[model samples]
Target: MLEELEDLFESSTIRPTFSYVHIILALYIFEKHPEGIGRYRLKENLLIGSGTARSLINKLSEIVDFIEVSGNNKRRGHVLTDKGLRFLKMLKKKIPLLEEGNTKALEEIIIQDKKLNAYICLVKNSADKLNSGIEQRDAAIKVNGSGATCLIFDGNDLKYPKSPNIQNNQVKIGYDLQKYFKLKATEHNTELDKDDVIIVGLGDTSERARLATLNSALTLIE
Candidate 1:
């Protein structure tokens, strides 16, 4: 299903700077702002160029009919259609949660000169897909992320899939994540299950961090 979403962004003549995560975020933005948002505001939220934002909306409107324009050029805005709502529902089933995180909790693991914005996402039932966590990190990096960390919840605690020796710090990281992320019993009304994967994406800006996090999470989605 995600691949189908990716297909919507694929082009033969030119490559798109934005990704499917951007599309998902755009839908989320519209859902949050029912009054609708203009292309410039959406572009600021997405941290992309005006042309790219226009292209993203054009493709979504013409190809999938998932969105419709509300106002004219001076204050043109967009709102999702019924089909887009259904599509977002489907995505939620796989990726139940996505949120910003406090990087202070991650300082021990991700040491850097500059402070970074982090976005965390919970991908359901995908722990078995992880090995050394390199795959998830690489996915985030490909999308211009500073880096990413992958952890798995084993019904009791969240731990790095490959690093078990640092149990003490791992426990602290997990606790801080749960505390700061303020995870719900079920974000989409789906309970947190054992073997659920958690991905933290780091970037210089919130938009980049979010896209990076979602990109990392998608690698674990089946």
Candidate 2:
């Protein structure tokens, strides 16, 4: 993926030094862990000396709106956005898989109890809305609210379903969920042990739905 991205960068005709740095850092962290590379960790892994990862992060932040950094010290960490994930997917197709040691960094992020709670809230509504929108393509339905929803399906029981025709708005949300979860429509429906899966709903309003989902999921994790 990194090699492919390097090729893309080279082909783009932009010769900015920071552009290469940003792409390399983004791909490195992303390839290492699809969830994202936090700022401090990225700095450590990249062996970037002198200037903080913040500079590179700030640059990449302009192009990829989905990379998130948080912490009181401003050294917390970062994660990929749905947009960032799509970027990685594009590169993955072109690059031969590079073998590396099994550090399990990215896997740790998603599987962590606390982080999983965050992801449940962050991803659930988008995922539900996406699925609901797809369902609407087959049967008439209206997406009347901005809030997200959650549903559980048996992973093993879920058979691959056809992709439903989607409207422009629905398509964007659906694509985001698909990219975020790294799963296809059929795969999304597959069931897992309750202990192994957590789902949450992000509703339309920050006050009512989204926050509530976050709190609920956090409680579950706690």
Candidate 3:
């Protein structure tokens, strides 16, 4: 655990004295970036000299699950294997590690300290409200002065009732929308907070496109 923690803190652009820390961080990042980060990117980000990086990577390939993937322009790069995945899981502990001076850390603080409940609802027609300078709307079925209602995808209303922990965790959904909406590049533009219920991808009325909207709602509500 300490080795993983130490690797997390090493500057991505600086070469630490220890080469093993570089390998540890690189593997974790490869797991996160499955498409394979480019060789130049790895060199620039991991700060390993070309010759040493090649030799060390070859050595690593002998003992662990490592592969190279080529992308457009045909530059091949490193990614981890199923064996590496199992190894990472063995190394990883259940405890969450919060990074300082970042939004995720701030979010962790909100969940751990402030006891706030955040819910996101995929909404249409909210733009009109925003354009008219009505930024906040309550959960109701209509665009009334007091409240509004909308359909949620996963067999639930887009209503976050007033209760501690939102009916004790029944109201919360944990679908990883980032992975689900991967092909929709524009869907990822929103700024995320730890407790933020981000409702985005508004104004598209196509049936399938709207299904994606429903997916966002369902993912959160399920």
Best by TM-score: 1
lDDT of 2 by residue, 68-126 (tens): 55332344456666666677666433221222211122232222232221213222212
Let me know the TM-score candidate 2 reaches against the reference structure. Answer: 0.33
How well is each residue in 1-222 modelled by candidate 3, as lDDT tens digits? 334333332444654343443554456557767777665666554555776566545544553435454343235566776766765555432101101112232242223322222222333222222221112322111111121112222232222323343445324333433323221223434322222232321212222222222233222221
Count backbone clashes in candidate 3: 3
Task: Give one digit per residue, the lDDT tens place, for model 1 in 1-222.
Answer: 766676676788897778877887888777777667888998998777899999998888888888887653336588877898888878877787777776777665566644789887888889888876888889888878888888777787777777545445444254665544435435446566788877889888988888888888877765
Q: How close is candidate 3 to the true structure, as a TM-score?
A: 0.35
Better of 1 and 2 by lDDT: 1
- Clashes within 3 Å, all models in order: 0, 11, 3
Q: Give the clashing residue pairs of candidate 3, or none.
A: 140-148, 140-149, 141-149
RMSD of 1: 3.4
lDDT values, one for every candidate? 0.77, 0.36, 0.36
Question: Against the hidden reference, what TM-scores do the models get?
Answer: 0.83, 0.33, 0.35
Off by over 4 Å in 1: 10-12, 71-76, 163-190
True lDDT of residue 42, candidate 3: 60
